[model samples]
Every structure is written in structure tokens, then in C-alpha cells.
Target: MIDSHCHITDKRYNADEVVSTFAEDGLEAVVTIGYDTATSIEAVRLAEKHERVFASVGIHPNEFTHEDSLDGILPLLSHPKVVAYGEIGLDYYWDEPERDVQKRKFIEQIELAISARLPIIIHSRDCDGDMLPILKSYAPRITDGLVMHCFSSSEELAKEYAKLGFYISFAGPITFKNAKKGDIIRAVPDDLILAETDCPYLTPMPHRGKLNYPAYVRYTIEKLAEERGVDFEYMERLTTVNAKKLFKKIVDFTGEKI
Candidate 1:
């Protein structure tokens, strides 16, 4: 299985050791996401050393600052292991500034994602109205594609994203009791589904509150398999296929070159 979104670069996770040990998690590939220039650089650097890890670079909504530059993000895409761009998007549920700043930064990041021509891993929260315009504007410009990371919406919202041909990525929240994400997952087409840890934040059930590791994603995979009522192997294959398409770096670095 693969973890399509995770902040392995976060200091709380002790990224240096975790990145080295990720392969032992039985993961074929993992995307170590970025929320700023420092973490973006860290993401790519970690991907460079580990075959099972890949990188996505972009800033977060809450991190928005007038001083933030598109150049802070653009250069990371040059790295061979950098398969995607972001962890970037609007988040109104938490600390929020004026709507204008949030909108401006989100668009700027998407524009960078377009220039880089890489998939964007979005962290949208409680600002769908504000976030929708940014996504709708550039639906056609990028080649790498897009994923709604740790999605926490409904079937209707899922269908909206599905129309854009975006993938719906599920994290530990999906496995939580009475999760509000059930309809969202149910609505996603099989091929458009992916899994994530969003590690150091939303650890999957059975290990909730523990420091998340890539290996713990196994629990999430099992939970999803049950949700879909399919065998575990089938779920694993489907997600790997999904990941390979969006994060092509994995197909190049994963496993022995048969």
C-alpha cells in the first residue's frame, strides 16, 4: 500500500529517522508533503535518499505571509523525487486572516503548481466556497493532477471534485468511529481513491493519538477494505495503481527494476 499524503518532514515526527525507516513499513511509496519553503526543501531532500519516499512542495493557508514568494516553491520541482506540489489550500476552520489574503496565497500556490505542472495535494477545510474558485480556475492547466488530502466532506462534494478528475485521499479520520467522511468515501470512484496518513496529525484508528508511522497505514488500509467489502489484496492493488498515476516518481524508484 501507499501513503499519498504525510508530513514526514515535520519536526514532531523526527523526520530524519522516520524517512530512513519508511521502507520497513512495507510501503511502496510515500509523499512527504510541504507546508512552507523550509519543509518543502526538507521534503525533496528526504525523497532523494529514500526510494520509498517522494516529495510534494507548497505552503499552507495558515502559513500565508506577504513575504512568501512563488520562488520559494518553484525550485523544488526540479528535484527528481519531487512528484507533486502542496499541502497548500484554504483553511477557515482554524486561524484565518482576511478572506483576501487567504484567497491570494491559495491562487499563488496553484499557479506555481501549474507552472511546475505537478499534482497538488490540497488541505481544504471549512472554506469550500472560497476554495472552489481557486480550483475551478485552473482545472485544465496542470499535468501532474490533484488530490484532496484528508478529505472531510460529503458525497456531493466528492462528486464535485470527481468532475475535475481529482482524487479523494482518506486519512485516519475515515477509520474513526462514526466518521462523518463515510459518504465522501462512498461517493468516490474506485480509481479516484487514495490513502494517506497525514502523519503526526491524524493517526489511524487502533493507534489513534500515537505518533503515526507509515506502517500504521496498514490499519487504515484494512479499514478501507472492510468499508468497500473487498479483499485486502484488491484494495492494496487499487491504491498502488492510483498512487502510481499521480506520483509517477514511485514507479521509477520503487522495487527492483524488473
Candidate 2:
């Protein structure tokens, strides 16, 4: 199993301890994502020290400031442990309502991802109005790949993204009793479905209200398996395979690079 997206870089958790517990949680790789330059650097630091941890560096929509530069981020892509270019995209929920600014930064990062030949981890929210069209416009440039992190969109939108070749990642919210998107999970094809912890946030049910850790992903895996009515091992194999397919830099259990 693997956590396609997480933030072990967050001050809330001990990075070393989290990396050490990955195996016990049945996780093979954990992508410690960043939302800005500072967090991006922290993510790389974690990835550099832990073989099981990989990193994705980018500025989240809300983190985009005039001073931030894509040039600074481009260099990190060469790191062996750096797997992707994001957690970047539009977020209307925040005070950063400048759509043009968000779009420009997102496109710049998309270009960087293309140049680096790495997939992008998207962090879209409350911007469905323009998310699909913007993604559609840039679909040609996203050659490596992309994923909708902690996706909370409708099944219809999910299908649209699937058609655009974007992988759909589900997090803890899927396990919430109020979550009405089980149909969305069932709707996604096995090959494009992925799972994530999005830790220190979106912790899965039964463990909700507590700080999330990568190990808690098992509960999500269990929930997804139950939703699909498949065996736990089957769901695990499916998501792991899907994650490896997108984040090609991830290594296998034998230390063989994928």
C-alpha cells in the first residue's frame, strides 16, 4: 500500500517517527506534499532522509504570493526522492479570490512539471466552476500526469476528470457517515482510483477528530474496500498499483526502483 498524498512536513507530527511507522501501517511509500517554498523544502528534507518517503513541491493556491518563484522550485525536481510537482491548483474557499493569479501560477507549475517529466498533485477545492475547463485547456501540457487530491467533487465531475486522464484520489472524508459520494468511488475505474491520508487533516472515520497519520490510511482502505464490496487485499493491490503508475519514481519493497 502507499499514501499518494500527505504532509509529514507539518509541525504537528514528528517526521522521523512517521516514516518509521510506514511499514507497520503496510505503506510502501508516502508522498510528503508541500504547499509553499518553505514546506516544499521541508518535504525534500524528509524525502532525502527516508527511503520510503517521496516529495512533491509546489505552492498551493492560497500560498501563492508575489514573492514566490517557479524558478526556485524547478531545481528540486532533480532530487531522486522528488516525485511530483504539486498540491497546486485553484481554491476558491480561501481569501485568494484572484482567479487570474491562481491560473497563471498553476499554468507555470504545469509547465514546470512537463519540463521535469513529473506528475502533478492537484489541490482543487470549491472552484469546480472553472477547474475542469482550466484542466482541460492544459491537459495537453500535463504529459506526465495529474491527480485530484482529496477529491470532493460530484460523480459527474469525477467522470469528466477521468476522461481527461486525471487520477482521482480519495481521502478520509469518503469514510464520513455524511459522505454521499460512495457512488463516486464505485464510479471510478479501478485503474485510475487512488487513496491518500492527507495527514494531520482529513483523518479517516473512527479515528476522525484526531491528528491523521499515514497508518490511519488502512481504515480508509478498509472503508473503500467495503464500499466496493471487494476484498481488502484487492483494494490495496489496486490502489498501490494505481499510485505506482502515476508516481513512477516510487521504489518497490525489494528496493528496486519502479
Best model number under lDDT: 2
Q: Which ten residues in a row have the lowest lDDT in candidate 2?
A: 249-258
Q: Report clashes for each candidate as comma-separated counts.
A: 0, 1
User: How many clashing residue pairs are found in candidate 2?
Assistant: 1
Q: What TM-score, computed on C-alpha atoms, does each candidate reach?
A: 0.93, 0.95
- Write the residue-wise lDDT of candidate 1 on 123-208 in tens digits: 88999887666687777775578999888877788898888888888888888888866556678899898888888888888988
Query: Which residue segments of model 2 deviate by more than 4 Å?
Result: 252-258
- Which stretches of model 1 miss by more than 4 angstroms? 255-258
Q: Could you tell me the lDDT of residue 213 within candidate 1? A: 80
lDDT of 1 at 18: 82
What tens-digit string does per-residue lDDT give for candidate 2 at 202-245? Answer: 98999899899988878788888999999999998888888888
Candidate 2 residue-wise lDDT at 209: 96
